[model samples]
Target: MGRGDKKSKKGKITKGSYGNARNRKAIKAKLKRTASKKTAAPADGATKQKRTIKKKAEA
Candidate 1:
C-alpha cells in the first residue's frame, strides 16, 4: 500500500496535512525561478501583428 508521506502514483501528495511537503517546496521553488525570467518582446518592425478571432457563423 502507498504511504501518505510519499509521492503517489501520479506524483502528487497523498495527504493535505504537510505529509510529504517536498512536493509543495519543489513547486514553489519552480514557480519562483520561472517568474524571475524576463520574456523578450517582438521587434517593432517585425512581421507580427495583432491577432483576431473569426466570428462564429449563425446557426
Candidate 2:
C-alpha cells in the first residue's frame, strides 16, 4: 500500500476524504464539546448580567 492506496491514511488525505483510515476522533471530540456545553451549569452569580433599559423623558 502506497500514497495512492485508498485504505491508507495518506491516500485518504490525498483524496480529501475521510473514512476508517482517518479515525473519527475529531468528530467524537466535537460531539463531546457540544454535549458538555449543553449540560454545563453556570455557577451562582456567574450568569450573564441583565440589561436595564432606560426610559426617555416625554417632551
Candidate 3:
C-alpha cells in the first residue's frame, strides 16, 4: 500500500521503473523548467557585426 513498497499480490509486480509517481512528477517538472528557461537573442547577428567592424578597422 505504501509508495516505497515494491511487493504486490502478484509477487513484486512493481519491480521495474515508474514505481514512484512522486519521482516521475519531479523529473517531469525539472525537464519543463529547463526547456522553458531557454532565452533567444532577438537581434540575431546584427549586434555582433558592429563589434567585429571596429576590431577590423583598428587592425
Candidate 4:
C-alpha cells in the first residue's frame, strides 16, 4: 500500500501511468477547460451581432 502499489498515487507516479489516484482532478479540469472553450461565446460582441444580422437577412 505504498510506493509500489499500483493503485496508490505514489505508485502511479513512479510507474509513469495515469489512474484514478494520479490524474482524476487534472483530467476533469482539462476536460472542463476544453468543453468551456468549445461552448464559450465569442470574445468580440460585434461578430456575434453580425452573424445574427446575416442570418436574419437570409431568412
Candidate 5:
C-alpha cells in the first residue's frame, strides 16, 4: 500500500499530531522550561540592557 493509503492502528493523525493529549502536555511542559530559561536573570549588564530593550519594544 502507498503511504497515504496506509492506516495506523494507534489511531494517530499524522498532521498536527500535537493535538494528541499526551503530546500537547509534553509540548506545554517543554515550552514552560524554555520560557523560564529565556527569562532567567542576566549575568552581565549588556544582556540586561538587551532584555530591557526587548521589553520596551514589546510594551
Candidate 6:
C-alpha cells in the first residue's frame, strides 16, 4: 500500500529510533580507514633533500 507497509513486509523498520551509537561509531571508523588510504604520503626521504639542494644552488 504505502511506504510504511512496504517496509513492514520486508521486515525492516523505516523509523528513526535512538540507540544507534554503535552504528555511528562503526561508520566513523570505516571512514577514517578509507581516508587514511587515500591520503598516504610517499616514504622515500630523498625528494625533500633534493629540493633543498636545488634551492641552495639557485641562491
Q: What is the TM-score of each candidate against the true structure?
A: 0.33, 0.39, 0.33, 0.40, 0.40, 0.36
Write candidate 1's Cα lDDT for 1-59 as tens digits: 36533455333344443335445677788988787653544568465578999999999
Best by TM-score: 4
Candidate 2 per-residue C-alpha lDDT over 1-59 given as tens digits, one digit per residue, 9 for 90 to 100: 77899999899888877899886788679899999998888877477779999999999
Candidate 3 C-alpha lDDT tens digits along 5-49: 664322233544553443657778998988776554455554444
RMSD of each: 6.6, 9.2, 11.8, 11.4, 11.0, 12.6
Model 2 alpha-carbon miss at residue 40, Å: 20
Root-mean-square deviation of candidate 5 = 11.0
Candidate number with the higher lDDT (2 or 6): 2
Q: What is the lDDT of candidate 2?
A: 0.86
Candidate 1 lDDT for residue 10 = 34
- Return the TM-score for candidate 5, rounded to 2 decimals: 0.40
Report the lDDT of model 2 for residue 28: 78
Clashes of each: 0, 0, 0, 0, 0, 0
Indicate the residue-level lDDT of 4 in model 4: 93
- Give candidate 4 misplaced runs (Cα > 4 Å): 24-59
After superposition, which runs of candidate 6 have C-alpha atoms over 4 Å from their true positions? Answer: 1-22, 42-59
Candidate 4 residue lDDT tens string, 1-59: 88899999889988888978988789789999999987877767545344444445665
TM-score of candidate 2 versus the correct structure, residues matched by position: 0.39
Give candidate 5 misplaced runs (Cα > 4 Å): 1-14, 19-22, 43-59
- Give the better candidate number (4 or 6) by TM-score: 4
Q: Compared to the true structure, candidate 6 yields what TM-score?
A: 0.36
Which residue pairs clash within candidate 2? Answer: none
Q: How many clashing pairs in candidate 4?
A: 0
For candidate 1, the TM-score is 0.33
